[model samples]
Target chain A: MSKNLHTSAPDTDTAIDRNVPEFPVAQDSDEQNYFKTNQPPSYLDQLHKSTKEFIQFHKDQGKGRKVVLVTSGGTTVPLENNTVRFIDNFSAGTRGATSAEYFLENGYAVIFLHREFSLLPYSRHYSHTTNCFLDYMTEINGELRIDPKYSETMHKVYKKYNDARDQNLLLLLPFTTVNQYLFSLREISKLLNLVGGRALFYLAAAVSDFFLPHSKLPEHKIQAQDHNGGKLVVNLDPVPKFLRRLVDSWAPGSLITSFKLETDKSILIKKSNQALDRYNHQLVIGNLLQTRKKEVVFVTKDPKIEPEWFRLSDEEVEKGVDIESLIIPAVIKVHEDWIKNHE
Target chain B: MSKNLHTSAPDTDTAIDRNVPEFPVAQDSDEQNYFKTNQPPSYLDQLHKSTKEFIQFHKDQGKGRKVVLVTSGGTTVPLENNTVRFIDNFSAGTRGATSAEYFLENGYAVIFLHREFSLLPYSRHYSHTTNCFLDYMTEINGELRIDPKYSETMHKVYKKYNDARDQNLLLLLPFTTVNQYLFSLREISKLLNLVGGRALFYLAAAVSDFFLPHSKLPEHKIQAQDHNGGKLVVNLDPVPKFLRRLVDSWAPGSLITSFKLETDKSILIKKSNQALDRYNHQLVIGNLLQTRKKEVVFVTKDPKIEPEWFRLSDEEVEKGVDIESLIIPAVIKVHEDWIKNHE
Candidate 1:
């Protein structure tokens, strides 16, 4: 068994060895050689490349341009079953969306995170645009017939939608629950990290405070059963205050604006002040919804400048209210003053 | 012919003389009736009928009940053109509707004067209902859904649309702008006068402050023109404060409740108190809508018991925490306490 030449032979010195020699591998290769030698790039790689290119292009254009992030509408909350609930409000997105466009018209990139039934047109021509889609499953009406001059607006929106569909951007995370809204806010906060200091976040979303605390996502579609004759007694949990958290966690230098809609003049002013104090926000826009005219009182922490309230007549408050003329100038002025004083 | 027929003519002459007086008297039979034979019923008739019915119904049911009138939603203003202008809000009729139902549940007859887009279900089951029709058109999915429940709610609304061939309520009065809202409110006030003091009025309509200062109803239908690509700048005039007018015009001892929603707590209380002072209202429901849960503070002009604030949790709030609970109970308690103390 050890020495038969015809069968197998250990040639004189061949033995079981502990140490074995291995050949050196190449770390780098030319493009042509690599293509020939390796597998094709994955879909993820192409997506990453495209996203990087888009980001780089935007970054280049965004230089010297202020950026605004406007959150609009009411968040929906999902129930135990597949059925969803919403913290519905009568916000036509008139104030926020209009303000956003005003900001964009004044040379700012707007990232609009809007909820369903928004009356403001998310035009693409406003330079840079991005939407945090939340109501994809919810059906929307046909495209609105807008002025043809707003072609750029249309193009930008189409591009954003296409990119979202292609997974070039993060697909909108749908939330119908308060907890989900909180989660979405947290996720948005993480995304804010990439925005750096050039970001101006306007939190105008009417987030609900109470949601089904014990709701559980169904593993499968549950059969429609009228539980207690469709009279549901939902036990609601207190939602975590995101605005309070945003002010607490974010850097103090960040410019944040909060809105307060009130009926009483004095109460609205006081609330605006409290908002400034609680959030450390640069400005608080307070308005009374009961009145026809969109009169807003801007409150800031600045001591030397008395808090000024600007009243926009109904005509002035119409769709074309120039944000630059009315409120933004004050905001910019305050910013300039703050910089001057701090420096 | 004269002599022989004279005898027969004498009878004819006598008959003719009876018809025509010697002094050329006027025809008594043909005389225009200065006094109306069938006069329409008056407030006295209504009072008699109501009293009889009230006594009979109480005798049959063996119970005494209070009556409440709740007015919810926005009113419209009439323009110079056939089209009307609306001053509306995003109220879903949740608060006012729920409070009306609460009154009903508490064995009180409710007169619900609701505007368009109200969530209150229209049924004959209600003790007495009156729907105040405002000339506002709401377009949903490109199709108009006119407020059809108008007839079930009010008699005046029935008279407005009853003659029209088109059953569509939108066609009855075309609301083009905010001016129409003022006109509508004026008409509603006239109707309110008919309701009398046995009713409690709740002013929950979010009325607009400014109206189209100059709007003319076109002799013919104004062809829809895209004015400067639909960028029309409308001039607005200030609308008269209806709540104040309502407070002044309402019958004495009528329990009136006004609402004020604010973002600041201290301001809300102060404003609510001021509302009490200005309007001399029995109670003011002050709510803060910053959070999802509607925590409302009720303020009354109770000299003995100090103003108290109650915080409802999310669940309780969502369960439709109504001002009626506080209102009805407090009203009953105050009346009872007054009786006991006076006795």
Candidate 2:
């Protein structure tokens, strides 16, 4: 086997920041440099305008309602410019979508940033992996109607969706690639800074930890025949640590909560604590992938208090009670206290 | 940079055929050995049972109806046993789903083997990437009803779907991984062989060309921090070439049509011809990745005849006529001819 690696700077007139040490230890500079080097998604301007419009609408009401930004699903890292292949994170966006509905129910203006085609709030109950949306609809006398068995629940979801739209309480923004997610995240956080302490950021998207930066990747699809013995070596750069900047600068007054999902239970809390210590964020929710729907441990900034556990009872599991139903209220209580402390 | 790689035999009772000279040039041996080595998906038994039931249903009718098996969408190649990241091919399953509708309209029993949650035959018109399905429905007097704008088309699609189901002319099967696809493909081909010349196989799935074989991957998710400089080298074996075996042995008498999708137009026909020469398959529909929806070229065994181009007219394109609507009819005509010639 042979190792073949070469890197070139991105072809752009935009002056990239070069004042950092090699390997970039500073979080803010890394984020700023990343944005300078890479181009944002084409639709970013339109998304920014729409989000601004939603923000203005809420402000006009003069109620000072809390605005929560919920990021959901998994972001993809493209291997080629044409993107014949990509590395995808495993997520269905169920936690974020379901939790968004609860946040809305708790009288918060919700902004949903989700992967394209992933689950959405109010639509989650009807759409599962196996059943087509059409399966729930049937035609009667040339009129399309929801299947009788599904109508009652569908009606409730429909009413909530309409109410949210009518009151202008929900905004949905979508992202697919890692670059798009990062760009959108920065723009959204900066926009929410205007709301000050009334803002909350629920960062739940399963973001790619590493990416093949533009300098390392080829412009076209990678050719299969180029490698010896069918070996493909990919060198990826660690994603710039942006949460530190989000907490310190971008949305300094907003209560930020990020999740750490691990397959192994042993390191979940330890990793969560490390993230909190490093970033100085308000909270880190640690969860094991296998038991995520049943239990979660919340780690906060206070050193005096131990990590708190939230778990659904076996009977509650059998009764189909979502763990988010329990998790959100506890977080709401913490958010209330944080607001009072900041005020 | 260092090339860190070592090969080891799979730890299983499965007798993997190691006799094939390293990277055997023949397609069939590569395919046969792939199945011999890798474990089939656990769901194969259920899929086999359903497919057998479909075959028996057709046989019991005693009408000698032609049956076509259409494979669609892209198959994932997992890099780990508990997959956190995987390589995904670029496909939406539009071609196969649209073509299946035409096959059903043309008096054929259709079996749709597709990626889970991809486009489906009658439901394609309603499901878009951005819109929630609930957007199409509105509450009228507390009853859920399709919005009037979409009602007419929804009625037509609904009627067609119900008619197909009532007639027992459609069987929808799903697969997400390459392993599941290969196993299901072999089983379906062998079962369809019982119907002889009356069976047609439409191979339209964008299958992964290379995969990280089980021998090379670990049972856990690959960590980004484990590697020096975050360099991940993945060695993927060429996907076992199965078309040769499909044409020669599994479903020999069945009329087979496969698709070749390339980004470059220069080598499109060349690659199609190469596949035909190597596999001895019936037809290869050559399409460019960018203009596939607007145009396609048909390449058959006869070199004397020029390759036929199927293009959607500007007026038809404006009126939302899919290219598959045109392509499927032409392919069906050729299948009819082949049936006569074989008889």
List the candidate 2 regions with Cα displacement exceeding 4 Å. A1-27, A226-228, B1-29, B224-228
- lDDT scores in order: 0.43, 0.80
Pick out the ten consecutive residues of candidate 2 chain B with the lowest summed lDDT: B12-21
- State the lDDT of candidate 1 residue by residue for B49-147, as single tens digits: 443444344334533344455656544432223231221333445566666645555555544555542444222122111211111112346443223
lDDT for position A303 in model 2: 89
In candidate 2, what are the lDDT values of residues B43-122, reduced to their tens digit? Answer: 89999999988987897794788999999998988877777677778787899889999999999999899988778888
TM-score of each: 0.36, 0.90
Write the residue-wise lDDT of candidate 2 on A122-166 in tens digits: 888766557766788876665678888888888888999888888
Model 1 segments more than 4 A misplaced: A1-57, A78-80, A122-180, A214-234, A250-252, A314-325, A335-343, B1-343
Candidate 2 residue-wise lDDT at B222: 44
TM-score of 1: 0.36
